[model samples]
Target: MNPARALIVDLPGPDLTLEEGRFLARHSFGGVCLFARNITTPERTARLVRDLRDALGHDALVATDQEGGAVLRRLDVPHPPTPMGLGALRDPEAAREAGAVAARGLLDLGINWNFAPSLDVNVNPGNPVIGERSFGSDPALVAELGVAWALGSEAAGVMSAVKHFPGHGDTQVDSHLDLPTVNKSREALEACEWLPFRAAVRAGVGSVMTAHILYPALDGERPATLSPAVLTGLLRGEWGYDGVVVTDAMDMRAIADRYPGGVGAPLTLTAGADAVLVCGHGELTPHAEHLNAVERALRDGTLAEDRLQEALTRLASAARRFPGTPRPYTAAERERDGAQVRAWARASVTRVGQVPRLSPDAEVLLLTPDQPGVGGPYGDSLGGDELAATLRAYFPRLRHANYSPTDARAARALLDEFPGAPALLATPTRWNLTPVQKELAGLLPARGGIHLALWNPEHARALPLPALVSYGFRPAHLAAVAQALITGEAPGVLPLAAPEVV
Candidate 1:
């Protein structure tokens, strides 16, 4: 009854196989979310969506976590820089333009719902998960840019979901690892954490995803996912958010570890969420079992029918708002959006430190970490090979080394051999440094040496060095950083939270 509540499934990419589409149709799931693994090209992605819709005979909610920058999920298609990179421009108009470009790209690939424009106010620079993904450290800046991005997405006819509601910015631990707890008082949350979510609600964001975080001050024993104080009391009652409230992936360690009895989906739904996400099979089986239990509870009159009806209504309203249609991007539009994203990326790059020029015969080593999971292949130069090529065009004698964690010692030995030369360390923000790399960083001359932390700025903060440079590490950002480094010009302002000197 009522479509058995809505569920969003994650696909490898835009291109779905016949078997995958059938599996989706058979399950009668409400929607699907795309990642880079499923996308190889725009045309192929659009075709896959079309095929799925035809097979399903119902408008499936096709969505993507296309937040741009380092969080970009679809590499086969072009999209703009991440929200933080756009925020770096410090221009609302630029942020809007980048948002429009991303919206256009998603729409072209037949993605209607964009789980993006993260409204999380990243006040904590050491936040591993949300560093470059967040708009900025300041709540006001995040609200302004987030609103612009939301409006842009709506304008392009793509439904936008501002997330992780309540807020996930200030926590030190990643929800992927364990449940993060926010001990800040209610007043503090309203002033600092809730600012951007409130702004998004005012701007008419279509959906808000709940975090797996626990706010002890809000509700003592339960995480936000299972806390009525958070979802019903704060979001729906106080803020009066009428949009769909979807829970973050239940498969994440935060919820899984706590809810060992597999009560997440039911608890989340009962707690006021419109939909609960069962991200992977490990969580899906339990979620399905929970749904059956919920049905049983309804039969026994333990779960109120009205509560289920309310959730159904929200899901139906959201689905009705998004009329599924194929929105293809022309070549000219693709180029235009690509250019806009690159311009924003260029503006977002920031140089945190400077290094003295090395001798003409010295080598400038570039080390990149390996890509995890089943997504795109890790680039030879930390996804900045093109930028490196551009650098070499001008400085042909510049030597570079690209190494994974396994070769950390070799990479460090190479750097040691060239001690007379100025060293440059380039690695993805996602890459965790090996012990050898850490030791090498200690050995390098602090003043004239440069450590360029590409990708996540949070990673840079962890390094035990005094002078560290952070480039948000998108393709355009890489180009911007390379140019800035060569020209001795800083790209943007230092992060609000700078690394402390040891």
Candidate 2:
């Protein structure tokens, strides 16, 4: 075959265009990674994928970042608990079940590849990008739960790409905008960041997605995706991982800012990346240009033929390994998953210290951050709408305001108008605390205030007790926080150590 599926491109929307079909045929693309916009419903997504494959006239992978909680492509459907929530549950069997269920849904949508089960150990409280995606801070726990999740996914025939390999959890910078540096010594990396990945490989994860982070200890200059030392030497040579290695989105500033004109495609292939991901809807380079650039690299010997064939082999082997048995998630499965998620919220949300109840007759103000648009990467970060809808049931007079740093002064003034009314500040993310979240929680009067850390328990300590760490902002999790604030009855314990639970 003259064409080898070496590239993974994204679609512009749910329906593939004629130009898109032509592009797929021209280059023999390996796969398409669908975003939220491409997924409206299971029926529509399945049709779109079928049409895509008919155009190619070849087998191709369909993927999405369907990791539960924060990054779900199918938002309309019920999902199991996030990795952090599952980590709190500490039941590897439960983690495996979540993975199996997610895989089934993905297969129903005609998706076979899932970029998920982040093996990153989130030890840094300041990591902006990977707060709740990780299973937990402890490497051992992350390894156990992550492997269980991955094994479950693979067993169900949907391959899991355990990601941001060589770790993206310890950095402060978001790779979407810039490259982050992880300054840990090799020894420290071995102890923390590398453990879960090692475990994933040992447990036979099908794929690994390389991080866009720079580890100076591994390679002095280049980021992991472009560094042979990290990808080829460490991952392939040392760890004996012969599976496919997919680079994270090439459009991200971490890669794009450094390599212009789609030159990174050849560089990544040279470095051991199997798939060159140039995402649609936000790609910088023209489609033809990326293909042209790779062709030129080949002509110039920058990309060796053997290297190209080797990468293709790995990608092909993955499809053969996890040829899924596709089945739609039944209505019963949806309700079952919904109940499991609700149970998780009930069992994992932590109440710190004595949470004071607000009088039903008193005025109450809830400050929250806004959720990103449905297609954005952090779409579910702030489920403020979900939280407010639930909280309104408890406090009839409750007024909710989406606040930014500019609204800090107004939020404080709004609190003063109520005199003795309690003001509640809720943050669904830890490292991602918006400026307004920090300022308003600080501005609230020490006595008549409630702070809810909806994602992590430690971040709740930023304010005072009388706070609840709900561990998530899903409808069920936020409902528990709403119930706890009004009745002082949060029952879930923190996955991590925390202060007294009310």
RMSD of each: 3.6, 3.3
Backbone clashes, candidate 1: 4
TM-score of model number 1:
0.87
- lDDT at 64 for candidate 2? 85
lDDT of 2 by residue, 27-120 (tens): 7778888888789867788888887676654367778888887777877667656788787778899899889878877887778899998888
lDDT of 1 by residue, 76-134 (tens): 55656767766666788877766777777787767788888788888876576776678
Q: What lDDT score goes with residue 408 in model 1?
A: 65
Error of 1 at 6 (Å): 2.1
Q: What lDDT is reached at residue 177 by model 1?
A: 81
Candidate 2's TM-score reads 0.91
Error of 1 at 69 (Å): 1.5
User: Which pairs of residues clash in candidate 1, taking residues 3 or more apart in a chain or in different chains?
Assistant: 12-38, 13-38, 14-38, 69-82
Find the 10 residues in a row with the least total lDDT in model 1. Answer: 372-381
